[model samples]
Target: MSTSPRSTTWRTRAAVAVATLMAALLTPAAAHAAPEESTPVYSYADAIREAVWVDTGLDDDGDGRPDRVAVDIVRPSEPAQQGQRIPVIMDASPYYSCCGRGNESQLKTYDAAGDVVQMPLFYDNYFVPRGYAFVGVDLAGTNRSDGCVDVGGRSDIQSAKAVIDWLNGRARAYTTRTGTSTVQADWTNGATGMIGKSWDGTIANGVAATGVEGLKTIVPISAISSWYDYYFAQGAPLYDSGPDRLSDAVESSGARAKCAAVQRKLVDGAPRTGDRTPLWTERDYVKDAAKVQASVFLTHGMQDLNVRTKNFGQWWDALAENGVARKIWLSQTGHVDPFDFRRGTWVDTLHRWFDHELLGYDNGIDTEPMADIERHPDQWETSSTWPPSDTRTTTLHPARGDRPGVGTLGLTPGTGTESFTDDPRLSETDWAARIDTSTPAKAGFVTAPLTRDLRLSGSSQVTVTATPTTRTAHLSTVLVDLGPDTVRNYADSAEGISTLTNRTCWGESTAGDSACYLATRAKTTGVTATVFSRGWADLGTYASPDKGVPLTPGTAYTLTVDLAATDHVVPAGHRLALIIAGTDKNLIDPPADTPTLTLDLARTSADLPLVGGAPALTRATTGSAATAPSFTPLDSVSAPGPAPRIPRG
Candidate 1:
């Protein structure tokens, strides 16, 4: 048929459009656009839920067979449906059946048929829908796993490492504890990013230190790097107990008989003498930081006496020296999970972190700020690097004041000596409270009020020269900020954040598992005084932590005591005090016969990690700092011992 000119033009346009559509369908870009959903690319409610027993090469229970750890997995259904694979986010925790996980203490629940009905926490609920699998692993010797608890030792680490190996096709996984039917992780892309809190997170650190090839990244929250530092601080025995108690506590469902011998081995290896034995060395992840192939995303509390800030500080330092990619969040809470204190933001940030690290998404997450610090309650600030990347150490000395047991900290060292006898019943709070008064337990020294704000952004130390009246003495030193400020009421029953009745959902949920969680708010209190940092050391370990040499009576020894790491800003017009004390009761077991220590003021000094060094400190204490605005003065936190709770899962 003959067509008009306008009809011919329309026919020609239609032919070109058909050709364009065919070409676009064959393009790689169009293939990627096949899934048009905005994330939630997979179905959480219909995910493939399964379980496996990964065989670890060690048998700590001496059962004459290798131990097999239980791993419960939930991956998106889209992997099998659409023929796509995804990475994994694993939380290998011993608390899966015992004490529970996260703030609400959620545990794994199973169906009547013995299949995993629910996985605890928001990880599976949130990440599974976003094209990630969540694996809740019962660490060997806990839950349904067949082994003994080695605490943070070889068996404990290998239990989780075996899971990573299984994913990478390097190890075998079975359908049952005693079955020969093997299961392969063909649905997974073999990239793992382990994340957890407390003991679970400690395993992540250990596994990463193993230089495992499949682990892409790790998010360790309030984790321990060294078992030695956990039980003792610089040779000062901080706890009366050891790993034996922790190992026994998490061996859920009464399989304790098998682990009894392992517990005894733990106690035997970890002596009360505070010496770093082979047991502590094996548990220490910081030494193997160079072997880590995965990028690290770490979070820790400034006032965390449980896992403590030293663990993060030392581990972060080691990671930095080894040139490992890392990011961090420093909170103000005490021994809390970021999920409880900063839930919504934490979930989102962690999602992005996992996406960028594991999924190989060039999302510019690594190019962003490396550190996020909660300076005050619910207030946060970001930086390119921690300690502002410009920090320097400034030395402040204790000078004698007119009153006995009261002194001043100055740029110049003071002559003469000051003495204080040890007290067995006092905590750091008691000594901090009586800074202005004369006390036999402690000698306090204060600096002139700062004229401007001064930030302390890293670890600090005190070099002390003292002569003991007896054969041995314990030394405890603290840095206190004597001014008004608002701090988290760690004194609160809940430890800083109180849970609210309100709830919010972060992702899609299943019938048995939830993406919703109770809200939490920072419980704050106005305080005139707060302990910024403190440290303790036994005189017997003065020469070295490896050896406990017998101290000579009336003999002088100069030793360096490293304080906990922190990021705190001393406001203008606030005085920084240094307290010299003995036996921070409840923190360390006190000796029956306490010794008196004579401190040579001229030979002692505190090395502070100041953001701007001496010049900034001089400007802050000299000029405009005097008349600066201040907060309302109130009582400080009246807590018991620094760490009254156990740090185990």
Candidate 2:
């Protein structure tokens, strides 16, 4: 064929294009290409909000059929069409339809067809567009799920586990509550990550402890690993009726009679004596920490008197013992969320964490420091590991003859005896008063003014050899930081973030959920002394949490009280005070009769988890005592009260 010059040029161009196309297709990069990262893959407006009832194989409400847990999910509409099998970020909570989630008390808003229009909190609004599914389950009985609210018992844990099973095609799920039409999660990659705070987070811990197949990671903030620790402290009841109150608060089905039998079981199982039973053992995730396959990212407030630092401390220790992959964030705010405390950093870090865990993005989050701790209000520092990795346990013995009502804390134990009567009427505030002034109800021991700053990173143990006048007596101990300072008061709100007039956006917004949330600032309060840690114990239950060992009258016995864990820095010139008293009126129910506690001071000592080299303690100058700083009343300075009934957002 005779070709013109133009025809030859066109033919050459086409041939070159074909060669380039074939070469590109044959390259390894073409086969293993990364997903486009310029913009999010899915549309938030087009997200699906549907319910699936997963069979739990138990008739928890006494019905003949198996109880199916109601799982309300919001995810990208075209995950399968996008050629991406998305993973799930599930938050199975009891608060979806009850007290709500977050600081605004946001509930699940629904559309006309009874579909969930708004999934509470920013999880759905933020992660759904990133090509991930967000599932919010109505744990067994709390919302639209079948069965009773068994608290942290088998039903609660299993109900959430069923949803995980359904995601991995290991359990049965239906499109409707009673519909026979089967629903499969074919679009899901079967890797799930759970995250939540408080009770919602507790569910995550419980589920992960079951060693579920597809659970990839969990971010449990301010969660309880042991329900026994939540309600009782070494046989001392934190509240008079802890389990009963908690069960009543989460039972949202309105048909109380339906779960009356289950409710009674919880109450009966949780005895007032604060002894560990099989019921508590079932709820104790610590016991089953060996089964956890998921990497954990835990966050908790050192000042959280509600859930308390012990919950996280004990859990953290257990996870470490099991050699589980974990990261932690310890804050000064009480029961507060990291999003509120560190806001921008928290959001960015969380996004990276989710991307790494759920989307399989190599974000290098695992290579980063494993622990982030708040040294002061709004001040944070990262460490290679929790408790600073170099923390040392230093023992400080109580010495007498320093001052009445104020004993010296030093390395050498002094000979003498200090007697204090257990007064049922004394509160923590009353014990604070006895620190300087002589009082028969409490014995106070203070370290001399520290020459250098000393930081404590973990729990402190106070062991006292004492003789009680009665067999049963309550021992309340507090670790106090005596220095004039201002700190974030977390005890005021559930999340420790007070709602403000300002609003800030975290991610994209949709018709159902907003990208913006009300701005929050840490509530700050000034104080000369703050209770760094506190622990209560019923002496009768001292020997074992499962057994009561009454003390013989006038017989000296060694009792150890583990104070709440803390991350606090006692500045130079400040003293660390240990207050040993009777019952803390604000926390525990007092014993019937008052008993005198005679402490053998030489045998009494406290072991502190010091973060650095032990600082030298200077003896008090005898010439003239330094005037004490004007102190803000402990009540005036916000301290966490009883546990809030609401879940974290």
Candidate 3:
């Protein structure tokens, strides 16, 4: 109390210095106590293989007993026998007994003794010899698990969570589904990491959002965070019976009657109305992102039309807002795994990541860049953050001349109007077919050739003030690159990979599980115009997705549609085009009646997140119309059809 302020400050600094010195001295000792990496610490031939059933305490099948998730584990025999506690790398999946995993459709192979002889992919073969336990759990109601498939619901998530609990000595497990023998994970250190792709990866995301203990990190590749967004977008139903069809596809039980009730619940819950309700909220991981305690490594394809880029875009933003540590790989391929895209680099990076997170290795991975974006095929660029963290949103208004259906994009407000009639039979390609001509089905607008290259890094927002001739109408907005170019045609391959006769190997291979896979190549397509991004919305749901307010005929209303996010570079001499049309027949249901839409040219504009370009308008009055080039219709090269079906694996 008698000490002066200056003297107190000096004392505090001295105390901090002493504590810092002590920590520095102790850190070296702690680092020395950590395990060292050596070649073949465990023998692959001597790895232990066994199975256990973890109790989730949920009777989703109504058998009066808790659901038991079947887990097949392979670990280092010598270390486990010597009482060494090792970390776990777990992959909980529903495809073990169904369509299988990877391009080869590799399923889990078992010996006559019911012990797992093979695990799909190289996770078990590559990691077990390096001193880690690899466990593959059959998700509830799939494979050997005892329950009904809930399709990312509570039962599905709990089944995986229970295994983590058992590893941490917080839950019960048995040698069999009804066996009296207790099975314990006494050899595990209780630090777990989950990884997978598609539905398998979706389970990892769901469990991580629960904030469960003992989970160190998760790698969700091409995963879904919200089922609602996956099937519907702003009241525009992408597909009918989406959930029901998915549940039916994954359930291995031939007896459909066994889970008829659950199937009915899924159908009733979805409703195909594009509205958020309690059912969707329960399945949305973004709503509970703040509860996540584990770090995340996300991977997705920007050209993935099946799951779409919005899934990763929205989830990544939510994780950032919650202050969660995250890393991402945004690729150009469609729904393809990184292993096939960048084999050598992917394996090396993944190995270091697992070591740092699960084994507590002091690697500098966390200090590296947070995002890797494939600017072009096989050309990747790493950045400190996604969207470049310096992207600017620039709005371009529609400027019209004497043309009735054609317009130009510029900074100045326009005076004329453009109109289009909703056509139910019109596909995305159909709209592009009329880009050079005046058509009633679509209104086309283009910008002058860019003087310099422009890079678009995120989603684009299209705001239109229009009046519908009918009470309700469907609107589709597309951002197109108007120039001749060659790009990957993801629409051809279901998984975005074409299997080649040539085979290449990655990682180590075993007799039971081969690390070699059929080589893959993207299907290349040449076209005069390529759609960079697209969006759809139901006009009636402009105000609220839950309820629709029918618009009065001739009453102007403003609607904003968020286009899918993408990472693309528009080279010089290329023009940007905005095509406004009716329903996209390839993706969604069309309106009941065709409606004519009158667009107010002055109020309609598009906000694009662009980088490395000056904000200048290309007005029709400034002699910029000469810079716009005419192109052959896109349909001349390829016609649009139904959206590509998602690959089973």
lDDT of 3 by residue, 139-166 (tens): 8888888888877889789989999999
Which structure is stronger by TM-score: 1 or 2? Answer: 1
Global lDDT of each candidate? 0.82, 0.77, 0.77
lDDT of 1 by residue, 65-147 (tens): 78888999998887666555678999999888888887788888998756788788888888888888899999888998999
Better of 1 and 3 by TM-score: 1
Per-residue lDDT of model 2, residues 490-545, tens digit only:
54654345668988986578766887988877777766677778888877765675
Q: Indicate the residue-level lDDT of 52 in model 3.
A: 93
Report lDDT (Cα) of residue 648, candidate 1.
Answer: 38
Steric overlap count per candidate: 2, 1, 0
Model 3 Cα shift for residue 571 (angstroms)? 1.3
The TM-score, computed over Cα atoms with residue i paired to residue i, of candidate 2 is 0.90
Q: Model 2, residue 57: displacement in angstroms? A: 1.3
